[model samples]
Target chain A: MEERIEISILLDFYGELLTDKQKNIMKMYYNEDLSLAEIAELNNISRQAIHDLIKRCYKQLLAYEEKLNLMKKSFEQKKIKNEILEELHKLNHQSEAVIDEQRIKKIEQLVKTAM
Target chain B: MEERIEISILLDFYGELLTDKQKNIMKMYYNEDLSLAEIAELNNISRQAIHDLIKRCYKQLLAYEEKLNLMKKSFEQKKIKNEILEELHKLNHQSEAVIDEQRIKKIEQLVKTAM
Candidate 1:
């Protein structure tokens, strides 16, 4: 993934663990693509302070990812969903020609609930 | 749920995060139904120490559940699976004579994955 997407993913998963001020700084810098000086000026902090805070937040987010691995589990689940979809397609296209709309819908709903 | 079952459920969801000794003590007490005295004797620790450690471990497990809610989620998922099964039963028994074995198995697999 791109660095920008990776940071946002980490933030999406664990940003609540950050303080409001720290989280705001991170959103501005990472999500908003603001320069350190721009963020520092907006928050009334030194550019160096903003730089250091972002550095800390980046490390903290990585640490949370390392410990929790919720991000990894999410990707694994997507893979499982794809695999299930393939199985459903095969089941529908089998030689028996037993494919029906109601059945497919019910099966799709079940897959929706599980994944 | 019974107290014993609840503890085991919490332990099952969050036990890996506990220290090996803490987890072992928990399993012995909750799953094995061992008294504090027996556990203390086994670990060569005082009964009071064992009691305190168990108290701490219980609090820690509850904290993990509070943060993660994985135990709560598992129960909720079980309920959803039951609901899906009910829907599936209705769909199978509906006007169409579509209660086939291969289709049912494939639909079951989808429910298995999502839940």
Candidate 2:
């Protein structure tokens, strides 16, 4: 599960850097949860070839992350967003009548926009 | 000024994909405000070669932005952050007695973290 999450995060940040074939294979194997044999059959390649391609894609994604740190920055942004939301929630509770409705709505908008 | 801003945004998003030489040339030309002749002399290359390298780097940066839209997303995030800050300021004004101190600090923290 942790590995899947990590791959999804990397794919989100660097998938465009990959070739179309590598992107498709990664989406199938990781996002669609397809087995290597299934992807190999679908793409008319050997299972071992599919395995190697996936490994190469993983290495490329990791290399991009290491160099750019986009995934790390994105995760930090998310953490800050959550912290802001929590603070907003506290403010909402402090003054429910005066600050809840519009402030909460704006906070929701900010969260959605950030995401 | 607008062109410089655009290039800076593009550089922030895709500069990591460039070669070290390309990166150095771009930084000297755009960020450091160096002339082509100056850069060429400093690097022991022809002025025409420096110009060509700068153009190639610009093309690669644009291609990356076209493929990934990371720069666009980043701008949108900044706009959202501004909107959130404005909303927080409004909230702060509405309830200075109750919400100003901690909420303002938290909002400042969020803005800095997001940046």
Candidate 3:
């Protein structure tokens, strides 16, 4: 995966555990695509401090992932989603199927529960 | 929920993030059903300090739950499991069903992923 995308996901999964300052800096760097110097200027801090803070934030997020593994479970959930769709596709093509909307809604609930 | 049971669940969810000492103390208190005085004597701490540590550990665990909500999500997954089983029950009773072994395997996978 791309670096920024991976970081963004870590932030999404563990962002609530972070301090607000860490979150703001992470969004500016990853989401807004700001330069380290620009983020430093915006926050009235030294560029080196911004760089270190970004590293510290990423480290903290990665540590949380290590303990909880919600991100990895999420990927597993994605695989399950695909498998469900594949089964549905098989049902559609292989027979005169009546996969009811209610079941579909329940399957959707299963997928939604992953996040 | 019962107090000890709830704390045990919290420890299960966030225990990995705690120190080894914290985990040991929590297991002794909750899992082993040890009293505060007994735990303190075992660990060579004052009863009051043991009491404080238990409260601190719970606060920390609850704070983690507040941020991550993995415990709540686990309960939701459990609810989903029941719904899936109920649907399966309905299907089993409503017809001479030909639910394939492969599909049952996949459903089993869904339930196992919650853990």
Ranking by TM-score: 3, 2, 1
Better of 1 and 2 by DockQ: 2
Candidate 1 overall Cα lDDT vs. reference?
A: 0.75
Q: Which stretches of candidate 2 lie over 4 Å from their true place?
A: A95-115, B95-115
* TM-score of each candidate structure, all chains considered together: 0.63, 0.78, 0.80
- Runs of candidate 1 with Cα error greater than 4 angstroms are A2-4, A10-68, A82-115, B93-95, B98-115
Clashing pairs in 2: none
Q: By DockQ, highest first, what's the ranking?
A: 3, 2, 1
True-vs-predicted CA distance for residue B43, candidate 3, Å: 1.8
What is the alpha-carbon RMSD of candidate 3 to the true structure? Answer: 6.1
RMSD of each: 5.8, 6.0, 6.1
Model 2 lDDT tens row, A1-115: 3987799779988899899999999999989999999999999999999999999999999989888898787776677577656756566467433545455565656555554
Instruction: Itemize residue pairs with steric clashes in candidate 1.
Output: A114-B114, A114-B115, A115-B114
Q: Kindly list the per-residue Cα lDDT of model 1 for residues A1-115, writing each as its tens digit.
A: 9977898888987787688899999999889999998998999999999999999999998887776676886777666556555555655566765545564564556455444
Candidate 1 lDDT, tens digit per residue, B1-115? 8878898988887776678899999999999999999999999999999899889989988887776676786677666566555655654566655445554564556456544
- Candidate 3 on B1-115: residue-level lDDT in tens? 8989988999998998899999999989989999999999999999999999899999999999998898898898777667555554454444544434455455546555553
- Evaluate candidate 2 and give its CAPRI docking class based on DockQ: incorrect
Cα lDDT for residue B58, candidate 3: 90
In model 3, residue pairs whose N, Cα or C atoms come closer than 3 Å (at least 3 residues apart or on different chains), thus clashing, are: none
Q: What DockQ does every candidate get?
A: 0.15, 0.21, 0.22
